[model samples]
Target: MVSAPTNLPSALAAALAERGHEVVVHTRRVDPDAPERQRLPSGVVVQQIVAGPVRPIVEQELAPWLGEFGRALAAAWRDDRPDVVHAFSWASGLAASAARQQLRESTLIRNGAAAAPLPVVLTFTAFGAEQHRRQGPVDPGLANRIRLEVALARSVAAVIAGSDDEVEELARMGVPRERVTLVPPGVDVSRFTPYGPSAERTDAPRLVAVGDLTPSSGFDTVIAALRGLPGVELVIAGTTSGDASEELERLRAGAEQLELADRVTFAHSAVRDPAARSALLRSADAVVCVPWHGPVGAGPVLEAMACGIPVVATAVGAVSDVVVDGVTGVQAPPRRPDQLATVIRGLLGDPVRCLGFGAAGADRARSRYEWARIAVDAERAYRALVPAALPAVDDELIHSNE
Candidate 1:
């Protein structure tokens, strides 16, 4: 992992580590004064790189960071190497690819013959181009990002998608179908389990909405839905704290303008921690995730389900792939407050059905979206790319010869 802040790589590294696989996270934080190395609770080694100034995630900063990361990775791999290099994003993929190339070249120089390219597995959580295409006119680095993804796809042995929606995007970007694997991003199911008794609010149906405060997040739509469902309060648990973000202010203004100030309470603090977030999810009657463009990791949705809370989400992006409409929970079309209100009302009206949905969602989350299962799938994808590691190939060759 090259970028340190994102939770996907950290969650994945921790998950893989728990599965008895060694995970080394290489990253650089914007705060140069931060610690150099730290060990995560799950036993993964996180080594921070000493790159340049604090910078935003743009092409200018990304290219230089990739170079810095590649050099460091190659140096480390040269001493005590790893079997496979798995990168979290396009920038990290480029760095990992460069390191692999350097290692291969060094091996060739030492020996008479060239060895096979070191297996590299890349996970692009979101394509910049794809996101731009969805929301109308293309973004600034649209061409550059697409070209980079296409180039990396050709070089990497395997590409693991965060969501099934990304699989088609990967294919469109020139990645072979065989090279792509759809592994939905996972949540810490063990911690987020719904083993405890329900914390239902007797006064009113409390609906929880967890995610960023951006306009696309659809908190406004959820608020609109709440107008029809009287006596229900919506708790928005993820807007940034301290000086409120523009989005947060906008949301507060919207709530006041809609005369929903009494019915809605913004948590103000972003619930990034799994335990806290899980607790927040558990405290709700139902969790609502109605993103206009769809969620990036489907984190909030999966976390809510894992906490045994029925979700009322818009059927968009990777959400449609994970949620079975009316089975696990309810699905409302984007920007439809009337339809969304009806769905939420139905779930709230039937306590038995809400309990059933919660139970079903929890079971599904445990079986399919658990971190352990996700880690194993990712591990297998990496192992499949490594020729020396795939001893089954040798066994097959021997059998064929016989």
Candidate 2:
């Protein structure tokens, strides 16, 4: 498995390893002092590779390093040729496909573009639009990033999309339907399920929002909604990287302006570290995740449902597919603070109704979004791409100089 060492990729790698697969993780960063080899319970072997930083390298330096990295990956593949190679994001997919070509192996690519338009462009455009609306026109690095994504997408053999929306987007960008597969992200229901009675909380109907403090995530919108309602505390969890500092500050200011500084508490920590995050979610009355523009994956929503917490999220992207409004949870219009506030308040006022939604959410999560089912689907796809065994061919030397 080749992917960036991000949250989703790490989780997927662990899940794949747990399924009795010999997983070799190719990452962009690996500390030299760290353990050289760590064995998983199912005997998976993880191999880490530091591909160097993309930010500091100039175009001239970048091209050469990428070529060298490609050569190294090719050499590794030739040494231990696997049945199939799975690449996780567009960039990694491009690199993995190039390496696979050298080793003559089949490749499977998974889309980790959480939001539509790629990460850099999405962030720049979102921040630019917000800044432009408030001040004036600004130069957003959107066009360049879109061009890069289009180029990268064209090079992959098969693109595994996280949702139908992503498939449609990839299709519009010239990727054929046959090349695209809709595979929604799955949650480990066994780890996230609400097994016992709901935990007790002292606060007046706590509502939680978990994700990075970025503009696209719209945690600010949740804060805005919280301002409209009294006796409701909104807990915002998740750490922000350098790019999101400005947005985080802006949200803090907004909370202060709305007199919700005391009501809204910001927890600059990860919402994925099982123990801490599970405890936080279990104590919540409801969970709210409203992203402005997203084919939102199964992170916050799934975790909340697993903890038997009703969710109120924006009806954008895959959220509607996850939360079956009124049954599992509630859905509000994207960017509409009033609607979000109303839904949150309703859930808080009626504990019994909220409990019913939570129970339904838990049931849906366990039934449909289990990681075992997802892993089987992925393994099936990998098997379909590779034949049962190889046939010996004539010893003919062929060379291409194109």
Candidate 3:
């Protein structure tokens, strides 16, 4: 697996490793003094490739060094080649593609015939064209990034989409639908559960919104929804203490302007600590996620569902697929605070309905969105690309363990 160091990729690598696959994660060497290779407790190997300056940098800025990173990967894998290379994000896909090409060229020179390019499966967390369409080319590197992303998608063996909306987006970008697979992101079911201790809250109904407090995050819509539901308090969990980003400031000012300063609490600690995040989700009457663009904000929504909390989300991306409307949760059009408020009010007013949604949500989350199931889905995609590469599963052993 190739990706920048992040929670989702790390969890996925660990899950794959636990499922008896030899997982090796390759990432750029961000810290000057960090080891080039380290083994995680989950038995996954982390190999940091030297690309540019050994310091932290954003993905957009890191693009220039991807070629060098690819060369390093090619050298490292010359002898110990992985059967399947799964890349997360556009940057990783570019590097994986380059490395595969490099290996193929090397084989052609060394042998009589050209060796087959290593099979690579890519998962784009968000598409560049989608973002450019929604937010414009705000980042200077965005245009070039979009071009590279489209080419990379075309070159990859397969593309794993996190949502149905993303699959459609990929098709519009000229990627064949047969090469795309829909595998929604997963949650840690054991950590997030209905039985866990909930965070302290007032008797008034509560709504929790989790994610970065950017303009596109739709947190302002959440605050607006509070205006309609008088006694309801809104908890926004994302920022850390002492970090004064402009977006966080804007959200605070907006909340104050709407006279919801007391009603809206920015829980800085909840996003950093897993225990606190789970507790906050458990305390929520419903978790709200209404990002204007981007892949379904899977982290917050899936985690909330796993905790058996009813979700009140925008009918965007794979959210509808995850949260069954009027069953597991309620869905409203994006940016419509009135509709969001109405849905929240309806869900909160009927405790029986809320309980039913929570129960159904918990069942859905456990059955479909757990990490174990997600790993299986991923493995299937990998095997489809290169069936002989992965080890065959032993059904008798699985049954014995169960």
Candidate 4:
């Protein structure tokens, strides 16, 4: 079940369905007139469960609507129960748990036999602890979110963590180590490749940074680093024009203050289109990802690598795992502009090293980060629970490249 607005859930659903699994996605109603059940072009079933208003609400505001959402899920699964209930976030996990409990109770009351419970698999995009550490105690909802995440982690059959850092964090929060699996998010290798057309660039070298235009995103560090590298231009591709207008202004103001306004370009519309985003990556001489926290995942870094562009990312989250320092790309500490600049200067100065890193990065991305490969890993996780819930037949049907 996808409880948030992130793209990962739908992408994963599509990938899983492509592997011949019967995937049904449950999400809250965003349009009042839309049908309750719909099918995507990829043939995945999507059920828009009624909970609250059709209007969009923040993730924190979703707490009050969960009961209704869970009931709706239970109703949908009453006639046909799925072997595994995979939830994409903490909110989804809570709703899935409630629905499973309701199903179990109904089965027990009807037949007087204990039905084998539906196993729920969970994946948390970002843990509350990481948020608390980054945003600090000023956030009022942080405590409650952390507590609920801990409880949900313990309740789920399996937890897929995007990074080794996340696995350690879950262990510190009291979740068993055995229950957590390390599965980094995948990238679309076919779309993001070196063969694609790149975004327009000047004769000067370019460094592209992609993420939300927030203070913690560390775009400022890139801007600061640009001051030292005189000839190179930087393109920070995020913060679409209308959305986050304030942040857009803030970043522009920072660039102006540093007297490097002409050198930096903000590609506002690049993120909304896959082709444009891939083009932007291909245009980059090197991609710089220096977010202050681990929640950024390895998305931009991996996409950049997939495009055969060298990366200079902070050693946080799965990015640290994906980028091999001095091999595929360079890794640096977060919030360090001087150190980041030094590496960028070195990388941009040597064309042979840049080509080497880019080639290696593309190889790693194709070999390890493909969507099909990730779907297989997820299928294995689902198969682990299926034997206890359903009859097992043949194992030869499944194959693995990892």
List residue ranges in candidate 2 displaced over 4 A.
Answer: 53-64, 104-145, 196-201, 239-243, 270-272, 390-402
- lDDT of candidate 4 over 94-168, digit per residue (tens): 888899899999999999998887788888867888888876674667788888999999988888888888888
TM-score of the candidate numbered 2? Answer: 0.81
1-402 in candidate 3: lDDT tens per residue?
A: 888754238767777878988787888887778787888898778887888988767677877788898898888778778778888888888888888899999998899698666888888877888888887555767888888889989889999998888888889889999999888888899999999899999998889986555677688899988888999999998642234488788888989999999999888666788898999999999888877766555767888988988888776777767888888888888888888888889889999998999999999999999899898998888777764534565210110000
Enumerate residue pairs that collide in model 3: none
Pairs that clash in candidate 2: none
Model 4: CA > 4 A from native: 138-140, 239-243, 388-402
For residues 1-402, what per-residue lDDT tens digits would candidate 1 score against the true structure? 444344337677777776666667776555567577777787777776654555435433567567776777777667856666777777778888888888888888999778777667787756776666677876566767778878998778888887767887887888899999878878787788886544444577799986566677788898888788889999998643234477777888888998988989876453755566677788899999888774345777888888889998876677777777888998888888888898899889999999999999999888998888987787677666666645442121100000
- Candidate 2: worst-modelled 10 consecutive residues by lDDT: 117-126
What would the C-alpha RMSD of candidate 3 be, to one decimal place?
A: 4.0
Give the whole-model CA lDDT for all candidates, comma-separated: 0.74, 0.62, 0.80, 0.80
Quantify how close model 2 is to the true structure by its C-alpha RMSD in Å: 8.3
RMSD of each: 5.3, 8.3, 4.0, 3.4
